[model samples]
Target: MNGIRKALRDGLVPPPPSAEPVKHRDAGVWTIPNLFTLLRFLLIIPAVISIFYIDERPWLPLTLVAVFSLTDWVDGFLARLLDQYSAIGAKFDPLADRLGLGLVVIALAWEGLLPWWAIVIIATVDLFLLFFILLMDAHQAMRVNWIGKFRTALTMVGVVAVLAGPAFAQPVLSTIGVLCVEVGAFLHIITGVQYARLAWLGRRRFR
Candidate 1:
């Protein structure tokens, strides 16, 4: 035992602990939250198909949309719960949401459920934000604020309501849906302006 102790002390045997630091794996693009985001994207095709082509079966598309929207919340919750937040997921989540909402808006406009002016307003704001983000490469840099989140939630609710209204052939539902969409659109504009201001400040700070 003394000999072994001496050997260890003299470094004849390797030390028990390695000098290297243990690498803790961080969450990446391929996480549960990301999967949910992908699922939401996939649902978009079906949702569009149901809205435009599946005229007789509105429930099918509505169900797909509802599930897709719910996944948005689920993925965000899971990201926090599982500590699986990633830069890619952050960008991808909102991109998926905007894409989904854009498609719905376009479809509604095409079907005459929504006015063209509303589409223009939403599209213009989104495009402006997209360009600003691209110009600044601020995908990871720009954090999502509470107002932005609230706007998105409200937009989703409005879109769902509008879609359901026409599907059920209910005038009251359609009216309410239109009102919700208009309100959501207004909120979207406000958030867009706020984002633009933020982007401007961010740009100035970086320069």
Candidate 2:
């Protein structure tokens, strides 16, 4: 018994506690992070407007898009940092992402900045993923996978690249951005399939 006690005292065993900090997912809805999320939606109006006036002020949409992305990061950062995670926020954030990103992509297509097929692919994937999420909500498999994260990053970069590239007359960037978007869209399909499989597995497991 003394020898076992000595081993524990000497830190010979790994700690049983989780290494990650605890986040309060059930925190209040009236928190700063939620406010930031609201602010993100407000910014979207101007982002879309800027797209319409891109020829008049080529930099506006680019800057707003950058800020829009910043808000997305900030809200999540604040959510974790302040531990203010509410059910409304948990639901609202992704809704905002899908809505905001969809609007931006659509607006880009409206302005001839993106192709209609890109819009179709993205919109289709989002709709399918939303359905899958609803189907599998009971399994608690709501966390994002690495592929989804990478796809989002690639898509955002593509958006910014496409905007900035044309504004600055840098065809190289425009090409790269379009490539990123295409690749991201392909990965989006992959993720949709992944989500469907997860939903099916969850249902089977429950059965």
C-alpha lDDT score of every prediction, in listed order: 0.71, 0.74
What's the C-alpha lDDT at position 89 in model 1?
73
Per-residue alpha-carbon lDDT of model 2 for 1-207, expressed as tens digits? 664454334222322323332344577669898998898889888998899988889889999987877777677766655556776676666666767777888888898878888889988888876676666543243445668667877888888887897689787887788888888888888876875776676567768
> Compared with the true structure, what per-residue lDDT tens digits does model 1 show for residues 32-71?
9899999999988788877776367867766887788889
Clashes of each: 0, 0
Superposed on all Cα atoms, model 1 deviates from the true structure by an RMSD in Å of 14.2
lDDT computed for candidate 2: 0.74
Q: What ranges in model 2 sit over 4 Å off? A: 1-25, 131-141, 196-207
Q: Clashes in model 1: which pairs? A: none
lDDT of 1 at 148: 72
Q: Which ten residues in a row have the lowest lDDT in candidate 1?
A: 10-19
